[model samples]
Target: MKTLAIVGAGPGLGLSLAKTFGQHDFRVALIARNQEKLDTYMQQLREMHVEAAGFSADVLHTAQLEAALARVKETFGPVDVLEYSPTPSITDVASVLDVAPENAQFQFDYIVRGALAGVRAVLPDMLAKGDGGLIFTMGGASITPTPMMGNVGIAMAGLRNYVSNLHEVLKPKGIYAGTMSVMGWFKNTDETPARIAASIYEMYEQREQGEHVFEV
Candidate 1:
């Protein structure tokens, strides 16, 4: 079975993604910083009858992230799909970010470079085979710039640019690259995760390359 590796896997959209692809026979690989959390996610996928495994690695470290992907490939075979969902380390994230602009680098490291590591780990093989899929969970700060999100918005903006560039360059090379830009209130829209997951699957099915925007 093909493998789908979800970096920064967590409870909400991550679990929805796991279920959506796992139910369709994709070997789900849960990648996260917490092994215990990964274990829980693994159990949940197993309960749902999905072949799944847990992996732990700090996304900020490219070497560690690449190593984790290598291990996944060794165990489950080449990753057919890569889902990157990065979270900022800063808890009290605010719109006015110049107060501690340095924090923005952390976001860039995890969100942008972290994603690059995953892509580099799998791109060669995909290039050789001439097909691949890359999906990103993005924020509203990317498409619409707000002064309040200056810190994270900087990194998010970079991520958005990279996603667009990658789509332009690699789509013709058979890599399906896109972003799920969440601009809505996820808490109020409980079903948004499922909808996003389904939309991701549809994008892959159609080999679509572009931004898939949603409020959730």
Candidate 2:
């Protein structure tokens, strides 16, 4: 079976993606900062009969992330799909002025640095295999650039462009890279976990070389 590595596993997107891919028969490796949460998620996946393994590491720690990726590869083989869905927010709705400089730095670190680290951690293996897919979750703030979410918006913009460039660089080698911009909040949508999973499954199934953006 193909393997999928999902970074930043959480309830909203992480677990959703895991469940989605697992249902489609992919051996999934879930990475999160909290061991308790990872264990719980693993249990839930087990109940569904999805092949899964959990790793705990702060994405900010590059060495930890690298080790986790290595473990995943050892267990499930080189990752065929990597989903980066980091939650980059200190306060839910802090104005530009209200957000502390440190908080802004954290957002940038989590969004930009985290994604970069993940790409670095997995790309070498993917490139060697000459086949893989990297999907990043993007928010509406990237295009709209809300003042209240300036830090996040700016970071997303940077990440989106970076992934675009990766797509161009990796396309010739049979690797597909892209972002899936949700465009709005997923919490209130009728798009259930299964539906989201189907969308991702279709994307990977139909992935073409040089494709960069997928606005879902």
- Worst ten in a row by lDDT for model 1: 90-99
Model 1: per-residue Cα lDDT at residue 82 = 95
Q: Candidate 2 residues 1-216, lDDT tens each?
A: 889999888866777788888877888999989888899989999999999999988888878888999899899888899998867644544556667777667677778888888888888988898999998876777666578786677678888888889888888888888776655555623455445556666777777633233344
Find the candidate with the highest TM-score and give its number. 1
Which regions of candidate 1 deviate over 4 angstroms? 89-94, 97-101
- The digit string of per-residue lDDT tens for model 1 on 157-207 reads 888888889999998898888887888557414888888889888878887
Error of 2 at 97 (Å): 4.3
Q: Alpha carbon lDDT of residue 214, candidate 2?
A: 38
The global C-alpha lDDT for each of the candidates, from Candidate 1 onward, is: 0.84, 0.78
- Clashes in each model (backbone N, CA, C under 3 Å)? 4, 0
